[model samples]
Target: MGRGYRRVHLEPAGAQHICANRPGARPSFGQTGVESSAMSRIRLAASLVGLLLGAACVPPPGDALEERIAEDPTLLRIVDRGELRVGIPTEALGIGADPATPGREASLTTDVAGWIADALGVEPSFRFGTTAEILESIHGGDLDLAFPLMPMTEGAVRSTKRSYTAPYYVAHQRLLLAPDTTGIDDVGKVCLFGDARTQVPVENISPGLEGIRSNDGQGCARMAASGVVDAISAPDLLLYELEASLPGSRLLEPSYNTEGYGAVVQYGETGLAGFVDAVIARAIDDGRWNEAFEARIASLTELAAEPPDLTAEEAGALFPRGLPLE
Candidate 1:
């Protein structure tokens, strides 16, 4: 197995310059129509225009950030490098939507990364990879911050090698079953991705039921839709996203287990972890996190008998303010 993740593109800081010259009044040829007062006003206007235009392109404070870097070597190293390498899993839905465009993505993970990147005064450069790869990257310093597939608090055991910020949301292991299946009900025909990263965990959590491990979620969902398998288990949010393709299919009444999710940093980089937790804290405090679920995961409302509660912290997040950073 690869020991670390591969590097991707780097986003450079937006640099800008301001230049202004006083409008000179010529003494030759003809009479200078413009008076000294007019020239002064013109100069003032030019100065203001330059100031505003230059301000538009200014990046965050380099020196102050550098000073903090001195205090926290991890932060300084990342800031001085000018970009925060982010490892993301493309297979994750709701948390990290796949079927993305060329450069950027719109999701809670990207939004979270963007927030922390701003606070750190660095651009977040994303690398698309698997959950295992992201965790390896975080441990090896190939990534500055990562949406490590590992859950933070709820149902999460601390890793010996990686440090974690407070969890941002909780995702549960949900079961989606087909209307009619050809197999025996003695053991539900559970579908899983062939990759061990996806299979091992689901298998460990859901024992006894026989699993039909495959290559991807779409295949598993397809099996369920055609009644080829009795059930397919994945993140509830992912199953909900795939529901449109599976008619008459149903989500199992109760979630099997809840797993928290959050960014994971390298171990002993307490400063970076604290900074990451602080960003999540501000988002939840200001209602952006709550507002985000309403906008993105609104379909979750229709999936249940009653309307889903967006106000409550149902995701096993670092509650009230945030999850502890360790």
Candidate 2:
């Protein structure tokens, strides 16, 4: 019943149809087979037109999403298909792991994804790739949802026309400084992993700050270790990983900006977004959220407080200029 919601009706292929003849009447004995077939097509076309004309009157929402999954086409499709297609970045530390890994445990992102699919009574399916690759899949409609771990910043919604749910997890953007570095000002060139989550906010941290690009954390680590760059900017969990791998590099105090990780869906998918938010809110209340976080990410970084839920408008105001979705 909400604005922006649409309900589509489709006729099943090869389905039986009523004849164009008079009600309860069969084709005349003198009618040819070709004449009958042409009449049937004409009737079908009229039926299609009626369906289109009535499309504006979407069915009201049931007691909840369970009673009428058809209220949201994306959710309905996921349920009908029996799977929730989720995307996670392969390179993001503590986000998710390859499901194919032997004896691999579910990561925080995967656990949250499972909660979502479970609520919908569908299987959670994951695809792993770089953030860009994942975004491409989302924009290309190859993915139903994505956990790119992108910050819910001001420009997030406008970045690619994709919708982001409230943050299920949050962290601050930190700097990994070279040996003997005092602070951000002490560092010359900063190595950005070329992620909009980091680069967009980190670039404006200091006036006239110069940023160099690396394809991944390993490259950034090597560059920092070899003195190629004075600092590497990223989230706390990633900075922790880089600090351990790159000796003499220290994670500086006082983060530059905060980052919130939210699930992404196609634009106008408010139905799916609301469902995702409910799943996360339930997880937070039932302790599943903390359990997953402790099991997967606690060892790497500690949170000052529980992550907050944000509206798209609030997210943009809190942390502006998020990643540009292509």
* TM-score against native, each model: 0.59, 0.66
Compared to the true structure, candidate 2 yields what TM-score?
A: 0.66
Q: Please list the residue runs of candidate 1 whose C-alpha ends up more than 4 Å from where it truly belongs after superposition.
A: 1-71, 97-104, 152-157, 179-215, 299-326
lDDT of 2 by residue, 177-275 (tens): 876566767887888873454445555777766888787778888887778888888777566556756666777767766667787998778889888
Error of 2 at 221 (Å): 0.6
Error of 1 at 305 (Å): 15
Among the numbered candidates, top TM-score falls to 2
The backbone clash count of each candidate, in order, is: 2, 2
- Worst 10-residue lDDT window for candidate 1 reads 22-31
- Would you give me the overall lDDT of model 2? 0.61
